[model samples]
Target: MKPVVQLLYFGYHQAMSCIFPVAIFGTLALTRIWEVPFLHRYDAILLILLAVQYLMYSSGLETWDEIKVICLFHVIGLALELYKVHMGSWSYPEPGVSKLFGVPLYSGFMYASVASFMCQVWRRLRMDMTGWPGGMASFALGGAIYFNFFTHHFIPDFRWWLTALVFVVFRKTWIIYRVRATTYRMPLSVAFVIVGFFIWAAENIATFLGAWTYPDQREAWRMVGVSKISSWFLLVIISVIIVAQLKHVKAARRAEPG
Candidate 1:
C-alpha cells in the first residue's frame, strides 16, 4: 500500500470519525453565518473549536505558530497519555487500538486536537493570553504542569484540581494585562450561529461513538443536542486562547516604544 494512499485513508476516517464533533460545530457556524440567536453562552465556541479541528485535518496545518505551540503541548501530552494507556490509567471505548504513529489515536489524538482547537477559540476570543508576564508566565508554567498530568508523578484528582487552580491564577494575572490585548466587538447574531453549529457537531460525534454516556442523552445513537464533552471542550479551548492571548500581549509590549 502506498504511504500517500494510506495517509489519505487515515485522514478521511480521522475526520469522519469526528463527525459528531463536526456536526455540532457546523450547526454553530452556519447558525452564526445566518445571523441567529445563540443557543447559549457556549454556542459560539462550539463553532470555533470544530472549525479549527476540521481545518487542521483537511488543510494539513496552515498556521505554523499556532500548530507549533499546540503540537508542542500535544507531544508532551501524548507521552503522558501513552504511559497511562500502557499502565491502564484509563480505558477507551475501543480496546487496544493503535494509530499509524504507533502512539495510539483512540483517546490521545482526540484530546490534543480538540484542545488545540479550543486554544484557537480562546485566543480569538481574547480570553486568556493578554496579561502581565510575572503571573502570566507563572500560568504559562502551568501548561507544563497540565502536560505533566496523567504521568506517574500526579494523581488524576490532583491534576484536575491543579488545572482549576492554574486557571484562577491565570485569570487574575490576565486581568493585570487587561489593557494589553486588542478587543474586538463581535456581532451577537454571527457569534451565536458559529458557536452553536460547532458544538452540535462535537456532541454528535461523541454520541455516535458511545462517548456521550451522559444520562441526558436519550438517543443512544444520536446526541442529545447537548453534552458534557462540549462543555469540557469549550473550557479547554478558552484556556488555550487565554494563554496565547497573554503571550501575544507580552510580545506586543516588548515591541512597544519604551
Candidate 2:
C-alpha cells in the first residue's frame, strides 16, 4: 500500500475503534438511557479504559480533581511514549507519529487524554485505594510484565547503574508498610508476580529460540534469548505501586452527609 493509502487506512481503523462507543452513547442519549451507572457499575476494570468519556459523564465524576489526575497521567504517558519513539526506543505500527511528534498533535492528545480518564474511572471503581497493603508485591511483579510486552531488550547502556534498584526499593517498601491488604490481596499480588516472571522468561526464551527479537536492543544486554528482565519488571512493579498508592474515586452516596 502507498503511504497515503496507509494513512487513510489507519485513520479509518482508528475511527472505527472510536466510533462504536460514541454511537452507543448517542443512541442512549436519544433513548431513556436507564443504564446510567452510579460508579463502576460493571466490572469494566480494563474495559473502562476504552469507554472513558461515556463513563465519566454517566458515572457523574466530572469533578475538577478527577479531571486533573486524568490529564496528568495522559500527558505523562503521551510524553513518555513520544520521547521513546523519537529516541528510537520503539516505533508505532503507523508512521503517523511524526505528523505531530511525527504523528498528529491533536490526534495524540485525543487518545492519550481518553486513556487518562479511564485510569480515573478505574481508581474510582477500585473503591478509592482502600486497604492496599500487599500492593508493592504485585507492582514489583506486574510492572516487569508490562514493559516486556513492548521493549524487553531496549534498556539503556548506562542502566546498569540502576542495578541496585532491587535492594533499595525492596528494603524501603518493606519498612514503610503503612497500608494493609485484605482477603483478595495476596491472590492479586501473586497473580502479577507470577505473570510478570513468566512473560519475562518467555520473551527471553523466544529471542533465544528465534521467535521475537528486539532489533535495536542494547548491545550490552542482548543474549540469544537471554536478557535481564529485572529493570522493566521492577519499573512496572514500582509504577503499579505508585498507582495503587494514589486516591481512588468513591461511588457517590444518595444521602448527603450535610
Candidate 3:
C-alpha cells in the first residue's frame, strides 16, 4: 500500500472496531438533544451499549475474552462512580429508574468504552511493550494511582509523586505497534499522555452532551478544565496496565523458548 493508504487502511480498521462504544456515547448525546421513543436517557444508553456489545461479538468485531475485560472495567468503574457521585465529585443530573445511589448504571459504560478502545487498538496494532518494569511495581503504581483518585479528596494528593515514579519506572519502556508492513515504536509514557488527552477531550464531549456534569458544568457547558488531563493521564496508566496484563502478555510469551 502507498504510505498514505497504509495509514488510512490501519486507521479504518481501528476506527471501525472501536466505533461501537463511541457510537453508544454519540447516540446518547444525540438523544439528549432530540426525542427518543419511550426509554429514558440512562435506560436508552444502557440498552444501546448492551446491544452494541452483542452486535460486536456476534459480528466478530470483538472476542469473548475482550468482552470479559470490558465487563471487568464496567464493574471497577461503577464502584468508583458510586463513590464519586456520592462524594459530589460529579453527578448524573438526569433521573432514571436504572440509577443506583445517584449514579446511572450506564455511566459505567464510559469507562468500559475506554477499555474497548484499548483492546481493539492493541489487537489491531499488534502492540508490544519492551523494557517494562516488573509486574509488581506496575501493579503498585497503578494501585496507588487508583487509590489516590479517592484518597486525595481527604489526604494530600500523591499524584505528582506517582507521576514522577511512573517516569522512573517506564523511562526505558517503548510501545511497538505495527502499521501495514511497517512497525513503529514510541516511548510508552508518550503514548499514555496522548491517549490521556484524547480521553479528556472525550470527557468534555460527554459532559457537553449532558451525559453527566461536574459541579461547575451543571449551569452551563464549558471546556473541561485542562487540569483534567493529569487525571486522565493517570487513568490511562491504570487502563493500560489492565489491558496489558490481560491481552498484551503474548509479546512476552513470544520471547520465551518454545
Candidate 4:
C-alpha cells in the first residue's frame, strides 16, 4: 500500500508538470465541441492557448525562464511548421484569422507545449545528464537534424545518418531523474525513443482532433504511421538539448529515497 501510494503520488506530480501541454492538447480536443460567437476555430485556438499560457505563468506553474524557453520553441516550431506546410507535408485545413503563410499561429504552441513539458519536467524531477557530448557537438547535431527536416524534400534525406550520429554522440549519456524520493537513471538514447513514441501517440490524437492533418489523413482519419516515431525521436533529441543548455544539465548524484 505504501509503495502504491508513492507511485501514485509521483504520477500525479508528473501529470501536473505537464500542465501547459495538457492545457494545449486539452483545448485542442475540447474546441471540437465548443461553439464560439464569431471566432474561427483556429483563431479561437490561438486565443485560448495564449490565455492558458499566461495563466500558467501568472499562477506560478511556469517560471519566467521556462516561459522564455517555451517561447523559443514556439518560434522554432512555427518556422518548421511554415516549411512543412509549404512543402505540403501536412496542412491546416480550417480557415483562420490568425493564419500566416498557411500555418496557424496556434500551431507553434504544439512545439511550445513540448518545451513546456521538458522545462516543467526538468524542474519537477530535478533532472540531470551524464556523459553528454558537450554543447558544441550536441548543438551541431541538432542543427543538422533540423535542417534535414527541410532539406529532405529537395535533397537526399540524411535522417539515418543523423540518427547514427546521435548514437555516436550520446551512446555514453544517461538521464537521471528524480521520482518521488527515488532517483532513477536511463540511457539518453533509450529516453529519446520512449519520449518519441509517446509524441507519436500524441500526434495521432492531435490529428484526430483536427489540430492538423497529414497528407494521408486528409480523406479519412487513420493512425499516424509507426515509422514516424523515428522522426519524433529525433525531434525530442533537439528539444532535450535545448532544455539541457538552459537548465545546466549535469551528472546526477546518488540521492537516497526518502
Q: Which run of 10 residues does model 4 get worst, by summed lDDT?
A: 249-258
Q: Would you list the clashing residue pairs of candidate 3?
A: none
The better-scoring model by lDDT among 2 and 3 is 3
Task: Please count the clashing residue pairs in each candidate, in the order shown.
Answer: 42, 18, 0, 0
CA lDDT, every model vs. true structure: 0.46, 0.40, 0.86, 0.89
**Structural similarity to truth (TM-score) of each candidate:** 0.44, 0.38, 0.94, 0.93
lDDT (10s digit) by residue, model 4, range 172-243: 999998877788899999989988999899999999999999999989999999989999999999999999
Cα lDDT for residue 99, model 1? 38
Q: Where does candidate 3 have its weakest 10-residue lDDT segment?
A: 245-254
Q: Using alpha carbons, what is the TM-score of model 4?
A: 0.93
- lDDT for 48 in candidate 3 is 80
Off by over 4 Å in 2: 1-51, 54-57, 60-67, 93-98, 103-164, 171-184, 187-232, 248-258
What's the ranking of the predictions by TM-score, best on top?
3, 4, 1, 2
Instruction: Look at candidate 2 and tell me the lDDT of residue 144.
Output: 45
TM-score for predicted model 3 compared with the true structure: 0.94
Which residues of candidate 1, in runs, are more than 4 Å off? 1-62, 92-103, 122-144, 151-164, 174-246, 249-258
Superposing all C-alpha atoms, what RMSD in Å does each candidate have to the true structure? Answer: 14.6, 16.1, 2.0, 4.1
Index of the highest-lDDT prediction: 4
